[model samples]
Target: MDIKQLQADIAAAVRGNDVLKCEVQNALDALSCATPKLKYLEIHVLKKDENINQFTNDLQECMKELGVLKGILPKVF
Candidate 1:
């Protein structure tokens, strides 16, 4: 099949499905695990305080996004 047709099929399938709570929770858990290691590495190994701060902030934003998605998905689907 052509790429365009394959893309359409995948899109259609995705639109029909609901994102499970477990999936979103798993993502949050991963971010929680990574954030600390990232912070420590940035402080000790990378020795880039600014980068660590930015990375931590980005992680926080991602967590917020996932939390919102988690809350909304149940209502949506």
Candidate 2:
């Protein structure tokens, strides 16, 4: 579930197809950006034990995006 591994998988999957490689690269860029932000917030901003519900929702949404993207590869190839 780590972003780096997922990125590597995507890169591998899309290696032979230019269009798919572009799309997968774009997805990976977005994931790379989002993952750091999420980690920063989780470690620094959310340390006071306040409003965990919102953090949980955000975390779920992030994971859901990864899940959807990961799911698409099997169907596509």
> Each candidate: what lDDT?
0.87, 0.87
TM-score, every prediction: 0.38, 0.39
The runs of at least 3 residues in candidate 1 whose Cα sits more than 4 Å from the true structure, single-residue gaps closed, are 1-47
Worst 10 residues of 2 by lDDT: 44-53
For candidate 1, lDDT tens digit of each residue in 7-75?
A: 999987786554555687889999999999998887776567677889999999999999999999999
TM-score between model 1 and native:
0.38
lDDT of 2 by residue, 6-70 (tens): 99999977775877778899999999999999998888765656568778888999999999999
Candidate 2 accuracy as TM-score: 0.39
Error of 2 at 62 (Å): 40
Instruction: Report clashes for each candidate as comma-separated counts.
Output: 0, 0
| Clashes (candidate 2) | 0
